[model samples]
Target: MTSLGVIFQPWSPPERLRETAVAAERAGLDELWVWEDCFKESGVTSLVVALTTTERLRVGVGILPMPLRNVAVLAMEAAMIQRLFAGRARFGVGHGVLDWMGQVGARVASPLTLMREYVPALRRLLSGEEVTAAGRYVNLDRVKLDWPPAVPVPVLAAAEGPKTTALVGEVADGLVLTGGWSADMVRDSVTRARAARSAAGVEGAFEVAVFLMTDFGEGAAERMEAEFDRWEFTGERRYAALGSVEEVTATVREVFDAGATSVLLQSRTDSDDIEGFVANAGRVRELLLR
Candidate 1:
């Protein structure tokens, strides 16, 4: 069965995080993804809160930027969350978008190199293995986690382009396909990433989690169009904005058929209408699951 999840954009007040998590759980979402995009509160912090509040749903940070923090800090944080959530925490890390990173005066150049070196070091540290490496971007000496996670922490690499996707397949456990991508776009990306994995004989399931937008109401078409317009203005990819419940179902099925082990919908709403979002998601879920 293809697992379906939802992305929680913590753009509202802190109180909204708990409320959204409760609502999403009731709505039958398998996972909840929180993101950090140069925002006020970090995604990991919000994820910790959500994990504390929720009972069964898996909580993940859609991505924490590699350039913004040290690898040691990341490893420590991941371990803490895994232990705190009783092993229900998953961490996704990536070289964030240039525009957003620039806001903090951070440069995210040569992401492939950064991720390639950063991931292994973080993994070794998290697993309590001695880390001794002198690489171009990262250099560590005899560092290991004092307290390792009891359960395996699945680290997903957020990749969009071919180079990054292949790198992710070669290293990380899964791939976090950037939201706003079309089904065809996801298919192409998965094909490339899988080929890389196959060549290396890495046999395991690679997650293809996508972020999407949904709206359910009589004026769904208009709402979807407005959502597309918002993406257009922000220069976000407009492929995930489907016009109707049927369109949303089709798009999701297309990705699933293309080898997405799971799909994560990042519902975008124009109003403070939680009921409307849940209703629209329910309709789309009914059509897709049926």
Candidate 2:
């Protein structure tokens, strides 16, 4: 069975997350995701709040920018969260928006190189192994998490191109695809990643978590179209699921059919009714289960 989730966009105030998480759990959604956006919310803090307030809702940080935090610090933070919540926490790391990274003086010339160094070190730390590495971007000296999670934590990484996608398959436990692109494109990415995994002789379940742009209710179409225009999206294939519960559900189903282990519903960032959107996603999940 696929895991269904909703993103509590960083655009929403931090104070609203507690109620939002409660709503997601109460409505029976499987996971709730948060992401770090530059000059915005802290993904780790948001994940903690959401996890603390709910008994069963799994919280994911779809990405923490690798440029902003040291590999050792991230390993410590992730280990603490995993030990506290056990299997309820999911983490993904990425290049972050380069412009945002530059604004904060954390930009790297080659993000691909950063991933090459960062992910392997992080996985070893999370697995309670001592690591020492000196690389272009990440440098550590026998660093290890003293309190790593007793159970293994799956570390996911975000990717857009073939090189990064293949790198993720070779080193990371899962792949996180950002919003946009059709279901067919999503399938291709997963296939490419898995092929890389096989070539690397990596074995285990490799997860694919996709973010699907979604909108529902009264101005769903207009909201979706407006967001698409802002992104300068040009495509005949629907980029977002829009309209009623049933309609939105069918559109999301296409992504599942294409091979996503997890699908995170990402509503428009400027949306006014986040809680309502979570509830609607719950209804969609019910239909999906049948």
Candidate 3:
């Protein structure tokens, strides 16, 4: 069965996360994702709040900025979360927004190279293996986690372009596609990623997780239109869902049918009713289960 999740956009203040997470679990949603966007709340911190507040509510950090954090630091943090929460945590990493990276002096000239080196090493470290690499970006010296997750934790990477997507397939356990992609685009991306994995002779269960842009309640249609325009989204499909819970649920199903392993609903950042939005998402999850 395809999993359904919701993104707790960083745009909302930190105070709202606990209620939002509790609402998701109370509403029966499968997962709640948090963003580690630059100049925003820390994704790991948010995850702790959400996870500690509710049982059975899996939390995912959609994509941590690879340039800013040392791989060993991430390994330690992720390992602790896994040990504490067991199988309820998910992690993803990527080249953060270039402009933001530049602001913090963490930007690298070659993001693909950084990912190529960082992901595999991070995965190994999580699996309790010592990693020694002398790559262009990642330079590790026989570093291993003192306390690794008891079970393996799959590392996911975010990708928008073909090169990054293919790299994700070659090195990572899962791919996280951002919002504003149509179902057809997701299908094509999955095919491309699978081909890359095959060419690399990598074998295992690879997952494609998508963030489907969504809006609910009053003026949802207008909000969605504005969001699409901001995203410069073009095409007959619009790549976002609005209107009723049933409508958004249908869009989620369409993306799942397009080969997505999971669909995370990305709502507007300035949404007024965080709890209501989560409950609506729970309703959508229930509808999908039926």
Candidate 4:
């Protein structure tokens, strides 16, 4: 069976983080993801806290921007988190949106190139292998992790476009796809990714995760429509209209049929809209589980 995860957007204070983590576990979510945004708390800290508070939920930082920190340091952090959490941690790495990278004065010339070099380097470091590489963007000499992770850590690459998706298939263990993908797009991307992976003779199955909006209430359809309008108008548009329980179910089915192994529902709501978001998650969970 395909898995279902939740993206925890911490648009609130830190104190609420623990409560939200606990609530998600109670809601029967398989995994919980947090984002690292410039205006919000760091994803790593939130992930640590969430992992400590929850017993069985797998926690992931949806993405840690490549340019934000050194690759060696990232490997160390990943190792420590994996060890501390007793192997209930996953890492999602990506180039991040250009606007956010600009805030840190980091320029990503070619994301695919950076990922190709960085990911393998991080893996080597995590395995306690001496890494020495000279790439166009990143260069390192004799870097190794003294404390390697117990198991091979799953690294998920966030891909949106066709090129990136294909690259991810070639390199990454799985994919954390963007939110706006349609069923047709999802199908095509997955097929391409799988073919690339297969051609390369990669052993394990690839994961495809799609983000979707969820809302449940009397005026759920209106609420969803308004949300769609905002996303489209603001140029953050990557969403399928999942207005009702049936619609959400259909969307999930479409994605699954399109080759997604996991679907993560991202609850987009106001700061004070927790009740509705939770209700919507419950409804979607019912549909997905069914």
Task: List the global CA lDDT of all models.
Answer: 0.77, 0.90, 0.89, 0.77
- The RMSD (Cα, Å) of candidate 2 is 1.3
lDDT of 4 at 189: 84
What CA root-mean-square deviation does each model show from the true structure? 2.5, 1.3, 1.3, 2.4
Each prediction's TM-score versus the true structure: 0.90, 0.97, 0.97, 0.90
Worst 10-residue lDDT window for candidate 3 reads: 230-239
Taking the tens digit of each residue's C-alpha lDDT, what string does model 1 give over 1-290?
A: 77776767756667788887787777776777888878666977888888888899888887889888788888888988888788877788999877777888766567789999998788777877888889777887877788888877877889978999998888888888866777777788888988998998888767777766655446765666677787663443666645566776787788788778777776664556664565556566677777
Question: lDDT of model 4 at residue 172?
Answer: 83
Ranking by lDDT: 2, 3, 1, 4
Q: Which pairs of residues have clashing backbones in candidate 3?
A: none
- Please provide, for model 4 over 51-156, each residue's C-alpha lDDT reduced to its tens digit, 9 standing for 90 to 100: 9999998887877888786888888999989987888887888888788888778868788899888877886788778899999877888877888888778777
> What is the Å distance of residue 175 in model 2 from its true position?
0.7
**Deviation from native of the Cα of residue 81 in model 4, angstroms:** 0.8
Candidate 4 has a TM-score of 0.90
- Minimum summed lDDT over a 10-residue window in model 2 is located at 229-238
What's the residue-level lDDT of 237 in candidate 1?
Answer: 60
